[model samples]
Every structure is written in structure tokens, then in C-alpha cells.
Target chain A: MITFLFYLPFILGFVVIGVWGERKIASFIQDRYGPMEVGPKGLLQTIADLLKMLQKEDIRPKAADKPLFLMAPLLIFVAIFAGFAVLPISPAISGADIETGVFFLLAVVSLDVVGVLMAGWGSNNKYSLYGAMRSVAQIVSYEIPLGITVLCMVVIGSTLDLNELSSLQGIFTSETTYLFGIKSLGIDVTQIGGILSWNIVQVPFSFLIFLIFFIAGLAEANRAPFDLPESESELIGGYHTEYAGFRWGIFMLSEYAMMLLVSFLASILFFGGWNTPFPNIGSVTMATWTSGTPGELSGAIWGAFWLIFKTTIFVFVQMWVRWTYPRLRVDQLMSLSWKYLTPAALILLLLCGVWKMLMV
Target chain B: MDQMAVYLFYFFGLLAIAGALGILITRNLMHAAFLLIAVFLSVAAIFVLGGAEFVAVSQIMVYVGGILILLIFGIMLTNRISSDKIDTGFGNVLLGILVGCAFLVWVGDYILTQFNDQKAALEQTNNQTEKLGISLIADHVLAFELIAILLLIALIGAAYIAKKDKEEVME
Candidate 1:
């Protein structure tokens, strides 16, 4: 009982904070003041939105499948909330903290697609059906690349444990190299000469895989540029044309939650999870930042601060991409996934697995 | 908490079985696909209970993310079945249920006789990555390579077929 109560506020805080963060990100990229009209630089904009959503009438068209219409919103919210339940914010600060954290996170997040399909079906509209079908096809193809790329990370990390992997990245040794080899210029630099070594520096090809995965992830998450399900111009809000009030709110919230989840994943996979950037400064010199204090309400909350900072960078980039790029047609989306990302991801995965084996 | 978890699992399990039956027996392809999602979700819950987290994740990714989408695409492209109704005979339902029940019983009996003894003693464990992965590379290597080949073939075939279909439909 205490645990559930303890976690609820944090969850709400995360959702509220996400809106603020998004506004901040928007402003930073576009050079315009965003959301200042709300409260104290739009800090309470999320709250106002919540209130507006609450007061708005829950509208369902007479043609809508009433039962499914009601259930779809709950399903979307539940799957996303379930996704967050497994994402660790800090050391000892996770909801579930299961050994297979990544798997749970992946599974719970992917379930979002089912609810989208249901929403489309229940509406019984043509655009809804088109949106739903496109969504299905898009997700199906992109998921292959997403899975393979994550599998490559699992190959590198040697464990599905997010914490373990992050901690491994915390190893700031100057001598460590990717696959324990110096085959970059056929000169064996570490053995022959001396130089700096990082995973990004050593296994540059795998890092290239990570970039592909990140873009593919952006597509997979169905954010802007890939948000065919809600392409307002084309499909008039796409699959969710009929949704109003809280049901619509739920759909919107699910999307933002997924956005945060993916950004956090990027952090864990590429930016060393909650671990700091300077490997040497993780635990010792960064005591002020690494402490497990909750709501210290301080100038610098290290663990949460670093994690959020890394996540913010990813989120900002996501928003930048969203604003800058034009949406791809359904055929283009399909071709991009099947023709390019999937094969590339598979090859990268194979290379990494072989690299790890040879290193061992 | 243990009792509550068990009860929750059982409730979902029952729902899964009912959904699976609906999926198998229903004539409407769309409804069956939705019901199959329910079955998949329930089975994922079972995987969670069994501590097979990676398996549960793969189940969602492969089954929901892959097969269900394929099923939907199939329904969309097919011309024979009208969206209004799919006529399934009552005889087929009865026969399907009976055969399904028999298969279930046989599988149950085999599970009980063959694995019950060992399963009782063995405890639920975590970290299946190494074992499952080893099998993927060692035992399922041929199948893995074949999947690659199959995907390549399917890619080419889908392109060719969809191209023809596009021309026909455009005409």
C-alpha cells in the first residue's frame, strides 16, 4: 500500500514535468518563447490542460462502438503506465526493478499499438481504418529493426539488466577498447602506440547502428514526421478522429509517455543510463550529484539531474526532427523500414555478436 | 500478495482461453484478430508469472507486432470476404471445438505425465538471455539463416505482387 502510494506522485510528477520539458525543448530549438502564457513560464500548463480535459464533455459519436470506445482509452493509458512501471529513474528508484528491465519496458511500450488499432476499429470510419492499417504495417516493419538493434546492445552488454549495462559503461578505464582489438588502421595502436579508447571510438560501426536504431525508434514511436495515425491534414486526426475529451486525453498522454520512454532508452543504451558522462567522475568526485536523496529540492540533484539532462538532449533532438522534417508517405515509410533499416540492423547485430565472441 | 498474483493470473488465463476460443470459432476475421490480441496479452501475463520476461517481450513483439499486423493486412487485401459478414458454418464450429478440446486434453496429459515430475522440483528462474541466445546460435542456426533467406524472398515477392496489384487497382 505504501509503495503504491509512494510511486503515484512520482508518476504524476513525471507526466507533468514532461509537458514542461517539451515546452522548454520547443523554445530552445525554435528561438521563441513557448508556453509562457500558462503560469510561471508555463510550468502549470500541464495542470491547466488536465483541468480543461476534465471539464470538457466526453463525446462519442452515435456510430461509435460504445464498449470498445470506452475501453480503448483505458487500454492505451494502462499499457503506457505499465511501460513506465519498469523504467528505472535512479539507483534503487524503480517501480518494478525486475531483472529483465529492458524486456518489460519494450513489451509494455509496444502494446501501445494494439490500442491504436482498436481505436481505429471502434470508430468504424474510413480514414480511421486507413490510419490503423498504415499504423499496423509501419509498426510491423520498423519493429524488426528496433528489435535487432536492441539485440545488438544486449550482445554488447552481455546482460539485459539496464543497471548492469549502465554500470559497465561507468568503467572509465583509459585502456579499454571495443572487442579488445586495435584493428582500426591495422597498426594495433594500443599495443604499438598509445591512444584514447571509447566504445564510440573503438566500435564506430556499432555506434552507426545505434544512430540508425535511434531514427528507427523515432519512427517506431510514431512521433511527428512518422505520426501517420494522427496526420491531421491527411486523415483529420487519423485513427482518433472520433475521440474527444478524456479518451482523447488518454491517447495524447500515451504518446507523450512513449516519447519519454524512448528518450530514456536512448540514454540507457547510448548515453550510459544514469551514469555520468565523465567515467572517472561517476561516484567519487560527483558525490553531490550521485547521492540518492529524494526531493532534496537542491540546486543539484545528481542522479536525477544527469539522467534527465541526457534524456533532455535526446528529446530535444526528437522535437527538432519532428518540426524540421516532412512526414513520409505510407509506401515510403514501408520501403524505408524493409529496404534499408532492417537489413542494416541485422548486419550490425551479426558483426557485434561476432566481435564480442572473438573478443571473449 | 502471492495469492493475489495467482488469482490475477488465473483470471487473465481464463479470459485468454475464452478469447482464444472466440478467435478460433468466430467467422469475423477482424473480431478474431482482436480476440487473439487478448489471448496474446494473457499469455504474456503467464510469461511474467513464470519469470520469462524476455520471452514475454518477444511474444508481444513477434506475435502482436508481427503476426497480428500480417493478419490485418491479409484481411485488407483479400477480395472474397465482404466486410459486412463472414459466413462460418455451425458444423465447423462444433468440429473445431471438439478437436481443439481433444488436442488440449492430449497436451495436458503429456505435460502432466512427462514434465510434472521435474517441473515441481525446479524453481522459476531469471536471466534466460544466455540460454535462449545459445540455442538461437547453436541449435537454431539453420532456422535463423533460413529466416533471413525467407525474409529476402518475401521482400522481393511482396514488391512484385504489390506492384502488379497496384497497376490492376489503378487501372
Candidate 2:
């Protein structure tokens, strides 16, 4: 019920914000104010962009797969929007807070690959086909490390519930410290890693894995660096190069929508999701969590307010990353993943796993 | 009045069932792919009526998005000649239709009577994504890992094949 409303606003918000982010990113990089002429500091840039795309033509090439050509855009939009069923947008502001939320998010998210493949295949252009194949290979290769890193988080977190992980069951203090039966005055490893022992902070090596995973995600989602699929400079609007109108808009919007979804996932898995770094900056009674029958608002339906607040902060961090980075070359991109990221992540996984076993 | 709603339900049910059978009976492989898309879209509608919005979206996404593309690509990459266009003869078509009709009749009877005909009976559908995720992690974790192995094998095989062509060209 409330989840549907959250899904709608969340999608529309990402679609609109993404366009603005893109314009702002361009201007910031070039040292000139982009879109300033469109609205108050180019706020209406997305609106103009939308209208422009709307008036454009819808051209299907003669040699393309008819059914699939038409199906590509719709499928991209569908898969991107579908992951919203599990994101914790607000305390009382999500669709279903399902237990297996994390896994579901990943499954629906991978479905975006199909849309990319279709856009490439259905275009019947050599560049689009090549770009599509390349995109799939890069995305699939990156997924292994991304997934392994995520699995590391899941192993530590134990439960797949986003909200549960966000609450931080693993917090430890100096008084409670035990390192082979010695309590230290200053060093609390729990404070360093927490209960789920965030993969990034627990091992210095995991940072490389995190960086690789983030970059790979950026590429897989066709957000610059790996955006050769839509490389306007060379392929002239690669993959869906010939697409026009709402279909093109949907593809672009799906990209932004997925960026948001993936960032939310990143936050959940690594950044303690919605856990306030400082404890008790917010706290709710179990009654509120189980509100309908109780003394607090746990079930009070507004219990998600804190959850949404933390998740959004993580989502914003993702936007910050997107605007900050420049594009990557194709060969460089493959090397970065295969030569550097993948091997590093595998080693981290193995070492961390063994270390975990030793400690236990 | 209640019977009227049941009849209305049967009308759309007929549309879905008949469409599916038409797909099975179609002679053209390309035509069959189109029919399957129709079947998938209709099943999505059914998933909606069954109160599984998420599953409905996934069914539409996976079947309509992924599998249909694969089927069409299979059709494209293969050189389809007259052999692929051969039709089942009249007697064979008649016999096939009779068998299909019998199967449908039996299934329809089962749907009406033996399944306890309860409105709530429609709710056994799992959250499609979650169920799939659980199976990936818990029951089929090995199989899921095997998917990785399979993909790696495919990538290598494709690379080897492509390399052989390159070597031939160089020679």
C-alpha cells in the first residue's frame, strides 16, 4: 500500500534528479554553469530534456528483431523499477520490508543486463551489437567480484534483512573488549568493524575490493567509464544509438534508477545501511516497531522514518561519487577489473574467510 | 449474479488458454516466439489477479525480456530453410488438436472441482524474487555456483572458437 506510493515517488524522483545531476556534473567538470539558461540555475533542465525527447522520432531499423526491438525499453524500465519493492526509502515509506530483501534486490537488478543485450541485439547495427556484447562481458565479469564482496557482507551480517543490518547488532566497546582474553583501553575492534564487520574497514585490503566493486558497478550499470555502450563520441549514441522518444528516455532513466538502487544496496551492505554512526542520534522503542499491539511506534507505521533518513544519506553519497568520477577506457576498464579488482577481491575473500575461521 | 462473474472469468481464461494452444500449434518458429510472448504477458495479468505484483513484474521482465530475446536470437543465428517451415499434416493436426482438447478439458475440470474451488486458493504464490533468492542461496547454492562455472565455460568456449577463426584468417 504505502510501498506503491514510495515506489512511484522514488522512481520519479530518481529520474528527475538524475537529469539534473548529469547537467550539474557536466558544468562542474567544464568549469561553466550548464543549463543556467533553462531555469533557476538550470532546475528546469530535466523538464526541457524530457520535452525534447518526447518530440523526437521512434525509428526501428528494418533488419532488427521486431518484437525484441519494441521490448527493450519497457524491460529496462520494468527491471529498474522492480527493485523498489525492497528498498527502505522511509520509516513507513517502502513497499515490502521482506526478509530476503538484499537478495531480491540483486536478482531484479541483474535483469537490467537483459535490457542492455536486447538494445544491442535489436538495434541491428554493428556498433550497437559490439557495444552490447562488450557491455555484457564487462558487467558479467564485474558481477563476480561485486557479488563476492557482497557475499562477504552477507556472511558477517548473517540475516538478509536491510533494516536488521542497519541497526548494528555487532557494536562493541572497550569494557567489553576481548582479544585472546585481554581488554585494551583504547583499541576496540568492534568499533573498527562492528557486528557485521563491514568489509571495507575490517581489512585494509577490502578497500581495494570496494573501489573495484564500485567502479565495476558504475560500468555494469553503463554509467560512464563503461558507458561505451552509449558512446556518442565514437559510436554516435551506442547500443540504443538509433532509439528516440520515450524509449530512449526510459533507457536513460533506467540507468539512473539503477544507480540509485545499487547505491542503496552498497549502503546496506557496507556503510552500515541506516545505522547512525553515533548511537542514539535516533532510537525507537520496540513497541513502536511492533506498534499495533504495543507501547511504542515500532508497528506505528512511521517506524521507517529513521530507516529512510539513513538510506537517503547513503544514496546521496553515491550521487556524490557519480559526479566526481570521469569516464574509463574499454581496455583500461577490462584490465582494471580482471587484472586488478577481481584477483584482489578473490584474495581478500579467501584471507578474510580464513581469518574469520581462525578468530571463531 | 455470482455465476455471471464466474462466466466473465472464464471468458478471459478462454482467451489465455486458447492463445497458448495456438502457440503450440503454430508452424512458424518465429510465430511461436510471438505467441509465447502473448502467453507470458497474459500470465503476468494472471499473476496480478493472484495478488503477486512483484512476481508479475518479474515474469514480464524475465520471460518477455530475456527468454524471448534468446529464442528469437536462436532463430536468427540458425539458417532457417524450408525444412523449418514444414507443417504437420491434416490427420496429424486433427489428432494433436483432439489430444490438446482432451488435456484442456481434464485440466479445466480439475480447476473447477478438484482444487477445492476456493478464492483464497490462489495465494500460494511466493514473492517471486525472494523465493528465487532463497533457492539461490539455500537449496541450489551449488547450482547457483554452477551457473558461474557454466558462464565461465561458455566465455572460454566462445573465445576459443573466435580465436580459431582469427588464426584461419591470419593463415
Candidate 3:
């Protein structure tokens, strides 16, 4: 409960920053200035927008189901917030350090779909319904590949605990003991930990797994070009079409929060959660800084700092892709997952299984 | 911890019953689908209280997340929003209520009678996932393999059903 309270504000604060960063990145991609007046480089633009949303009149469609309509956004918010409960910002800072952390994370994150469906249904709008349906298909289809990739990581890591995964990628001393003699491959020159100890680098076929996972993560988060669910040219505003004011803001908040959550998971699984990429080569105490010692305040602080740093990079990439690519058609989106990603993930899973056997 | 578990069981048990009642009484089919989600979630809570965390998460992921979304799709895609009522008719409704009551009473009686006599030991292991994985690979390998094949066949059948026929394409 204490961990949840600590992360609640931390997550909200990050969401605000993420909103501003997304706009700035979108503008930068299109060669324009994004929200420069609200604060320095429009830093406070999200705050201004939040106030504006609060002041706007909350409107409900006459035909809408009143209770479900009112509850939809709150449900979405809660689903994302619940997902945060399992995510470890630092080794010592997590809401629930349950053994089924990964499974629980995936389960809670998938709950967002229910909220989206409810929003679309309760709104009683055709476009909203269409958007919801598309979203359901996309999320469900992409989830298989996303899950496979996560399983790939889990198989390599040999643990489902997020905190343990983080510790396994420590700056100086990582979990090379379980590398199944793959550490003798000579690619990992510096045994004294760094990027080489990261899952994407250490685990066999992990590069491909990371690629597939990243793309699937993008789809699951409904980021463009896979944003068929809400493609403005086609579906108006998608499931949140009938939503307005703070209700609409809640949807936006959930979207960004989901994006961050996926990005953080990617970082935690692949890029080394809260572990500095630099090795302990000098007298700089990089090991001390990156280590997740439970009682050490510096370790906790730096651990969180690195985690946020890696997660931010992934979020930026997502934003860049969102602005750079044109949205995919629904058919193309379906084919991309079923035809390409699913087969690729399956093959990769098989190959990784073989690789693990060899290492063992 | 035992007290907490007992309280949680009562809470989720009531929640599950309430969800079932909601499903029965709700006029809207969409609302009933949502209520089914509630029932699924409460059942998952029960599984968690029993220390089957993997089963609880799987229940949520597969039933609540995956299958419930499909149910919602079925409801929405059929354009049944405005006409969401499930017409059981007067006689059928009474029969359904009577059957439901009788079934509940029988189950309650059975549980009450067997509760003390069948006080099975709780799981001593914390690593249920590892145990589950091992059993699936070792003792339950054949059943697991058969289930995999069955799922594959089901997938193929679904694809066959969904695909356009050659005659339709020619037309």
C-alpha cells in the first residue's frame, strides 16, 4: 500500500511529462514548434490542458447508458493504475512483490480492453462501436505474439519476478551464472556487467525477440501506424469519440500511461531495468550507483533513475513512430500480426528453446 | 493471514453470487456480459485466496480478458444494443428460477455437509508456477500434448469456417 501511494504520484507526474514530450516530439517530426507558451518549451502545456479539461462541461449523450458511460474512463484509469502496482520502479519500490508478477502484470494490463469496450458500448455511437471492435481484434491478436516474446524472456531469465529480473542485469555483477555456458561465447567480453548482461544482448535470439516484442507492444498500446482503432481519417476519434471534457482526458491519460507501461516492461525485460549500461570500468562506483541494495538509498534512487531513463527512450521511439508512419488499414493490421508476427514469434520461440537446450 | 483469507473468501463468494444474480436479473444482454466479467473476476479472486495465483491470473487473462472481449464483440457486432433484452418468457423464467434455486440449495447443502470432513491441506509450496510447469512437462505431458493438438485443430477449424468459399470468390 505504501509502495502504491509512492508510485501513484510518481506515475501521474511522469504522465504529465510524457504528454508534453509526445507533443514536442510530434511537432519536431513535423517541423513545427509545439506548445511554447504555457511554460518553457510548453512544459506546462499538459497542466494547462488538464485545467481546461476540468473546467469544460461534462456532457453525456442522451442515448448513452448513464452508469457505464460515467464508469468507463474511471475503469480504464483503474486498469492502468492496477498494472503499475506490480511494476518495480526500483528493487525496493514495488506495490506487490508477488511470485506471479509477470502473469499478474499481463492480466491487469489486459483489463484495459474491458474498459475500452465498455466505453464504446455505453456511448451508443456507431463509430465508437466500430473503434471498440477494431481495438478488440487488434489487441487480442497482437497479445499472442507479445506474450510469446515475454515468455521468451521469462525462459531465458528463469524468473517471473520483476525485481529479480532487474537485479539480474546489475551494472557489475549480473546473473551470468544461469547463462547456461553461453557466457563462453566470447561476445560478452566484459564479464564485469554492462549492456552485454542485458537480456537482448545475453540471451540467444533475444534481438529478434526484442524486435517482435517492440512491434507488438506498439500494436497493443494502439500506437500508430497500428492505430486503426482511432484513425481520425476513418473512425472520427474511435472509442472515445462520444467522450468529452475530463472523461476524454482520462482516456488520453490511460493511453499515455499504457504506452509508458509497455515501454517500461520492454526496458525491464530487454534493456536491463534500472541497470546502467556502462560497466564498472573506472573508479566511478557505477556498480554502487546501479546496485539495487534494499537498504541503500542511493541504490534505490539511481536504480529508479536508470529505469526511467531507459523507459523514456523507448517512449520517445514510440512517439517518433506514431508521427512518422501513416496509419495501417484494418486488414493490413490483421495480416501484420497473424501472417508475419505470429509465425516469426513462433519460429523464434522454437529457436530459443533449442538455444536454451544447447546452453544447458 | 488465516483471518484475512477467511474474510477475502466471504467477500469474493458474495461478489460471485451477486454477479450471478446480476446476470439473471439484468434486462440488457450487454449489461449481462459485463456482469459475467464480474463473476469471472470474483472467481479469480477466489482462486487467489486459495493460493492458486497462476490459476487466478490465467482465469482473468483467458476468461475475463480474452473470452469476455469475444462475448462483447458478439453482442456489439450483432447490432443488439437497443434490443438487448433476453426474452425468457413467463413460464421459462419461472422454471429457470426454480432450477437455479434448487441447484444452489443442493450445492450449499453438499458443501456444509462435507466442509469439516474434507478439510484438505492447503498448498505448502510458494512456487506454484514452477510446479505447474514441471507437472505439465512430466506427469501431465500426454494430456498437455493432446490439449495442444486439440487447440491447433480448433484454430484450423475456425479459420476454415471464417474463410470465404471458392464459389463466393468466383461470384
lDDT of each: 0.70, 0.62, 0.82
Off by over 4 Å in 3: A171-191, A282-285, A288-294, B80-91, B117-120
Give one digit per residue, the lDDT tens place, for model 1 in B1-171. Answer: 268778987988998999988976787666787789889988988877766767788898689766776775676557342244444446676787799899999999999888856745435654566778788989999999899899989988987875766567898
TM-score ranking of the models? 3, 1, 2
Report, for all candidates in order, the number of backbone clashes.
1, 18, 0
Expressed as tens digits, the lDDT of each residue in A171-286 for candidate 2 is 42122322221233234445332322433444335556567567766766777656766777777777787687888888887877777766676665665443333322125333
**lDDT (Cα, tens digit) per residue for candidate 1, span A1-360:** 322554346556766777777777778778988888788888889899888888889888777666666777778778767766655555445446667777766766667677777787778777886777677667667777887888788777777777665544543223444333444444332321111232444455767777877877887778778988678898898778888877787777777766777787777776666555542232344433343343343422454666777877887788788877889888788888888988889889999988777653
**Which RMSD does model 1 reach against the true structure?**
5.0
User: Would you list the rank order by DockQ, best first?
Assistant: 3, 1, 2
Complex DockQ, candidate 3: 0.66
Error of 1 at B135 (Å): 3.5
Candidate 3 lDDT, A275-342, residue by residue in tens: 77876555765555466465478767877888889998999999999998988888998999999999
Worst 10 residues of 1 chain B by lDDT: B79-88
Q: What is the lDDT of residue A288 in candidate 2?
A: 24
- TM-scores of all models? 0.82, 0.67, 0.94
Residue pairs whose backbone atoms clash in candidate 1: A289-A302
- Interface C-alpha root-mean-square deviation, candidates in order: 3.0, 6.3, 1.8
What does the lDDT read for residue A66 in candidate 1? 64
lDDT per residue for candidate 3 within B68-171, as digits (tens), equals 99988886767665444444323587788899899999999988887765446555467789889999999999999999999999999999999999999999
Fnat for the candidates in order: 0.47, 0.00, 0.66
Residue range B58-162, candidate 2, lDDT tens digits: 685567655675665566456432123324324577888799899999999988887675776655565555576677789989988999999889978986775
Q: How far in Å is the alpha carbon of B100 misplaced in model 2?
A: 7.5
